[model samples]
Target: MREQLQELLEQRVLQCVSMPRNQLHECPGIELKKQSCAKRSAEIVKAKANGRIKRKFENQENESVLYEVHFQYLIKQRGLFYMEEEVEKRQVEFYKGILVSDEKLNEIDGPREDVEDIPVFSGHEEGQERKGFRYDRMKAVQYAERWWNDFNPAYKKFEVDCTNYISQCLHAGGGPMRGYPNRSNGWWMQNNNWSFSWTVANAMRWYLPGSKFGLRGRAVDSAEQLKLGDVICYDFQGDGRFDHTTIVTGHDGNGMPLVNAHTYNSRMRYWAYEDSTAYTPNIKYKFITITDDSDA
Candidate 1:
């Protein structure tokens, strides 16, 4: 019976992935359906037996394939009338019809210089003015701690709030907003609208260093070099696409950055997330240091 059940479980997973895209609506047990989003969802549908399957969609022409599987099964105990449950999980990834390599998966997107020219900062008193503002690390860290869980009424909340939360922390630390009405550049937020850099993880990565004024940061060599209030970006799959961001709030005993983040509502957690499902061996990171705080 156990063998038969195991075979059936495998069959169900196959069926779930093989079902026609149009027929997806008929299968309510499937938790996630977005073709463009790089997320996988699954669940168990039997008594004392649980199963989960995850898959990624590349493009409209490609079929989604099972990438991961998790299952819990009941096993008979030695000389006992009761049964014991055993859990198992498996991960598989393929790229271009070949297995992916850790080195290839860890490759991150390099810095770009295609952003709008940085406005020159003119050092002038009252009558004269500078175009960019400085960043306050202390104020940013304070703001992060203050609103680790609470939502700020001024900004629009997103289903994925990591980048939005980081932007607020940067703004609180005195990062000035530029290009107010324009969404192509700057870090300003008005009503439900905001600059792409202000709310998107990948965009912020490019905007910070590219901007000569307002919010500016330089890339650092290591995570340990980061001070309190520094920012870190994560590329979970290392496909040059950054999907998450976090703020440094504290440090561990070994001096690792302890971070605070939204979306999962974590506070002062360890920076290296080896336990996360999104975590990959090829994970890439970007450490940013806000350089100029003269205005702050």
Candidate 2:
């Protein structure tokens, strides 16, 4: 089974590298890559996938097994005047020794429907008192790359941890924490308690732009305008509920940001999640450049 898992990873990489579009209909990522490359007059020159089995469960009752494969795909493309490379890390599940469905378990991040909507904090009305703090973009990117595939012991890990991880990156970059003891208030995670903005994607998405002080954000026009340590929020359903978030860690040859994120746990991934299972044609994105406007 282990050997077959490795073989499957290899075959998937090969398919992405050279398979026809009709044959690769199941691989949306690769198909989207091909479309992107065509638009830019680029061609994929190299591709590979390294797989590590994170967990496996076997059931003798029906000769079936489930394997959680951590897949890291490296792809290189060459255009007329530019060359670029990216790595996408995502966990895949296999059933009965092969993939029964490629749907990711940790993808969507809408508010937990079982619970009532969280209390909202009006950042604009109740402006937070912030001290002078400068954002360290390089340090944030360093922290992002350091822990993209792993969790830090110092922080609590959540099931849908995309925003939690991004908040950590911001903190690592010298972003100050505030609004403690109130989960609905300012961004913070301390003493085992946290703010909604620190863990909830939608909360952070709203908190940043509305925040008047302390680790605020300025919305930009597009992903290209964002610098390292900036953020991109996702509304996969375009229902006005922003769901997932990612921090910029690197940029491609074209200057578009390459992002690092949790939940799916990726690094140097393309900013637009065109291939994500949660993606819809109506997907909306919010490009926010993390700001340190004032300490007042």
Candidate 3:
């Protein structure tokens, strides 16, 4: 079942990549549109099975299964005469399911839904200082701006190091670690090992809101509301699967957030990320307001 689902997703990705601009408007289950910009190219970064659900058929030998796959890709564009290139990161969810027959599968409604609304996190208690220590935001931003290009030798680095770098900045700014020895929960790093929240984008999404004592964050409505030392998470595919993270270091003259990130190593870059190939019209964002223990 998993293999079949994977094959189906791969085929859809190929279709999106090969379909011409004229035909993209007519393609089913695919979204392609021309931007105001010129030049064009496409690339798939990765795809993976995230989860599954099974429903039993009454008195039947078989069951219905729904599989969720996360797909990440990039689209690049340039002017007709200009050599400069801009890339947008994109992600989309593909659902593959098996029923009694192809007819039954065809009867499923909508097959997919728009990006799920971000879960709401409760506000901090009135006048109550949060538990744990606080780090200096200026220091965290300094670290991010200073080390985005240089690797910190203290921790292990991966080819995809965005989340790891963000975690370091948050720590430097005084976010405390919890749930040590349990990689599935908490945010901690010791001896080259770290929690999933410290290293994975999706895990950190849940961790920040669910945390009670360490590394808590309050969700804001938009990027404009985020302050320096805050964080932004991206779901290029709008599938509720966050794949990238960045730290706010400064705001532009227009008060737009400017961020620093690793993996691609950007410094004081614009937060909108319109230049990334992974970007899409359906992109989703999470603006996090890091809570400090010193606030009362």
Best by lDDT: 2
- Clash counts for the predictions, in order: 0, 0, 18
Superposing all C-alpha atoms, what RMSD in Å does each candidate have to the true structure?
14.1, 3.8, 12.1
TM-score of each: 0.56, 0.83, 0.57
Tens digit of per-residue lDDT, candidate 1, span 200-254: 7777877776766657787898989999888898878787767788899876445
Candidate 3: tens digits of C-alpha lDDT, residues 41-64: 323223222223233233354444
Please give the RMSD of candidate 2 to the true structure.
3.8
**Candidate rank order under lDDT:** 2, 3, 1
Of 2 and 3, the candidate ranking higher by lDDT: 2
Task: Order the numbered candidates by TM-score, best leading.
Answer: 2, 3, 1
The residue-level lDDT of candidate 2 at 51 comes to 54
In model 2, the Cα lDDT at residue 250 comes to: 79
Candidate 1: pairs in clash: none
Shift in Å, residue 64, candidate 3: 47
Candidate 1, after superposition: displacement of residue 42 in Å? 32
* Predictions in order: lDDT: 0.60, 0.74, 0.62
For model 2, residues 167-252, the per-residue Cα lDDT tens digits are 99999998888887778888899999888889887788888888777788889899899999999999887887778899998776
